[model samples]
Target: MIDQLSLTNFKAFRSADIPLAPVTLLTGLNSSGKSSVLQAFVLLRQSYDSSTLFSSGGGLLLNGELVELGTGLDVLHEDVVHTPGLPTPLISIGLRTSEGQNFNWSALYAAEQDVLTLHSASDAQRTKSVFDRRRFQYLKADRIAPATSYPKSHHQAIGLGFLGASGEHTVNYLRHHARRPLTSKPLRHPKAQTNNFLDHVVAWMQELCPGVNLEATEIPGIDAVRLSYGFDGTAGLTSSARRRPTNVGFGLTYALPIVVACLSAGPGSLILLENPEAHLHPRGQSRMATLMAAAAAAGAQLIVETHSDHVLNGLRLAVKNGAMSATDTAVHYFRRRGLQAEIVTPRIHEDGSLSDWPEGFFDEWENSLEQLLD
Candidate 1:
């Protein structure tokens, strides 16, 4: 897992080094650079996946499947700080591993070009463990909504075991790997019908909506799969009439990939989630946090971006409940200072209490109460 991420003259950061943990939570207000941090991971993943980063004449591809960060002018820090000894001002991204290996990439700035040429060391010699691995998932915030059918990509769903950046291939993945055994004990759902992947997925989805069961079936002669949900009592009473995603509320399908991503996690996997709590209720959001912690305990490294306070409290609850060690979790509260983004990290104790609560850091409830009382 990445121990730290350093940004030099990157978007919204002149120079910043953010510490990472087994489970890292990035929370802050709008446009405070939280998404930018996650974008860096996707950027690297995109470069590596396209085989450009590993080639001799390789560089950063600004537009790719994982992320579409525009030209150099858009990504270059507004007020760039140059290295004292370097002749040119360049954009550098450095990733340091827990085992003390460093991977640094520096790109020359072009005003309107999408691809930034590399000015740094050989990408072949650098450690590409996290970005190059197959067990990686990056779910974007603007994910797929309620749809009648989702596309099926054999290479992505079967060969790569990828659920897609927007989880567009999730139904196909489920249809193919439903019966696969869940090896991770912590991620297994006790109430699940079997030890199979699909069963565990249904059991966890039931947490969001009670008695809810789902199935993914391949459409005949089509490169697509369909998802259908049915309640327990309704299945027996109404001759097993299933409900499409459009009929059910938005939360279940929206959160499906998150559940699958967490369940699929294992040792050496890296999962990056953007707004995992989107379209879910407060309780569902909290449950998502617990699942994230459980994934960490099961040996996967998760980096989550969320704005929900319930998610924060649920992480604290997980630490207190012994699901994961407090020391293994890191919470970063981001806020904009002038033109740059500054981060303030609050420590979590064994008791699930925070060392400090900065202003605008999930304190809206207390602030509103104070106003009402006054």
Candidate 2:
């Protein structure tokens, strides 16, 4: 797993070394650089997949599968530093693995060009395994909404085990791997009917909405899959009746990819999630955090970008519930300072309390309560 990420002259950061943990949470105000951090990894992964990362062309592909960072000027830090003799301010992205291997890829800036040329770098091949398609998943915030049909991509869903940045391939992936036994202890839901992946996914989704069950089925000849929800007992919808995802709540479809991603994790897997609590209720948001904690306990590393305090409390509750260790978690509160972004990390204690609570760090509720009392 990557132990730390270093950004130099990159967007929203002139220089910063961010420490990562088994389960890292990035929380802060809008555009405070949380997404930028995840984009850095996706940029490398996509560039590597497209044969642009270290090819003879040997450059960073700004527009690719996972991210489209645009021209150098768009990504370059506004207050970029100028070293003594370099022609252009180099933007660098590097990572140090827990195994102690280091790889830094620096590129010289070009105003109009989308791809940036690498100026200097260490041996990048030694760390190539970190970007393996099977071991990584980056889910962006604009996830799939409630829809009757979802696209099916055999190569991405089955071959690469990717759910897409928008999690568009989730239903197909879930359908293809439904019967696979989930061997990871921490990830296995206790209430699951069996050890199957689909059961575990349904069990976890029940936390968001009790008695809610799902079925992902192939849609005839076309490259598409259909997702339907079935509520248990004689309620609004009968257990025997199948309802399209379009008729169900948006939260279910939006949260499906995250649930599947967490349940599908294996040892050494890396998941970068953006707004995992999107469309979820407060209770369900907290439940999502615990599910992520379970993923970490199962040996996957997760770097989550969220704005929900419920997610934070849920992670805390996970640690308190012994799902994971406090040492395995890291919480970063990002805030914009002038023209650049900065991070303030708070230490999570074993008892689920934080060592420090900086201003504006998940304190909105307390602030509001105080105002109401006044």
Candidate 3:
């Protein structure tokens, strides 16, 4: 797990050290640099995957499988200070892992170039960073919507265990690894019919929508897999009548990858999720946070970017319930200051209380309530 991430002249941050934990939540108003924090990790992960970071003359791959950050001009901080002797300001990304390994990658800024040349010598012999590990998942804000069938990629889903940046490979992964054994007891759902991975997935997904069971199967003779849902009772749809993902509500299809990713997480796995509460109701949003907390407790590292206070409260609830220690969680509130981003981190006490409540930190509920009362 990465203990801290340092950014210099990268995106909205001129210089900042973002503290990380087993579970770190990045929350703030839109456009306040929350996504940028997750992008940094994906940038490195994609760059390494493309072999550009480890090659002899590797640089940052601006567009890749994980992220498609534009040229250096678009990513460089707007108010980056140019040194007197240096022709170009260097954008650096540093990471300190929990094992105390420090990895720094600095690139020379090129206004129009997508791939920025590394300022330091490229060395592939160094130990692997958590980002380079195979057990990683990055789900972007814009994910796959309701579809008849999702593409099946054996190399991506089975070979790498990646659900894709947009979670497009999730169905394929589910079809391939459905029966795999779960490694952690905390992640197991008591109501699950079996201890297999698929049942556990169905059980937790019921939290989002009760009695919802799903199936993932390969669409023969094609590079696609199908997903369908069945409800338990004689309600909208019965268990005998399986409905395609297109017929199912958008929320279930939208939240499926998230639930699968959390269930699949284990020790040394790094999961980065953006807006895990996209289409779910308030209670379901909070339950998603519980899933994330359970993932952390099971030894995976999760860095989540969310705007829902319900998700925040759910994490607090998880802590209060002793699912995870307060020390394992870090909450960051990002706000814009001039042309750069500033972060205010509030500590979580053992009782699930926060060390401080900054003005704009999930205070909208209180603000609206006060207005209503007045």
Backbone clashes in each candidate structure, one number apiece? 0, 0, 0
Worst 10 residues of 3 by lDDT: 121-130
Best model number under lDDT: 2
Assess every candidate by TM-score.
0.97, 0.98, 0.97
The whole-model C-alpha lDDT of candidate 3 against the native structure comes to: 0.90
Ranking by lDDT: 2, 3, 1
RMSD of each: 1.6, 1.1, 1.3
lDDT string for model 3 (1-374, tens) is 88999999999999999999999999999999999999998888888888788777789888987788999999999989665678999888888888888888989999999999888632467746455557788999888899999999888888888898889999998999889887789899889999889999999999999999999999999989999899987386779899987777689988999999999888889899999999999989999999999999888899999999899899999999999999999999999999989899999888988999999998988999999999
Q: Return the TM-score for candidate 2, rounded to 2 decimals.
A: 0.98
lDDT of each candidate versus the true structure: 0.89, 0.90, 0.90
Clashes of 2: 0
lDDT digits (tens) for residues 67-144 of candidate 1 = 999999999899999877876578888888888888888888887988888888435745556564678999999887
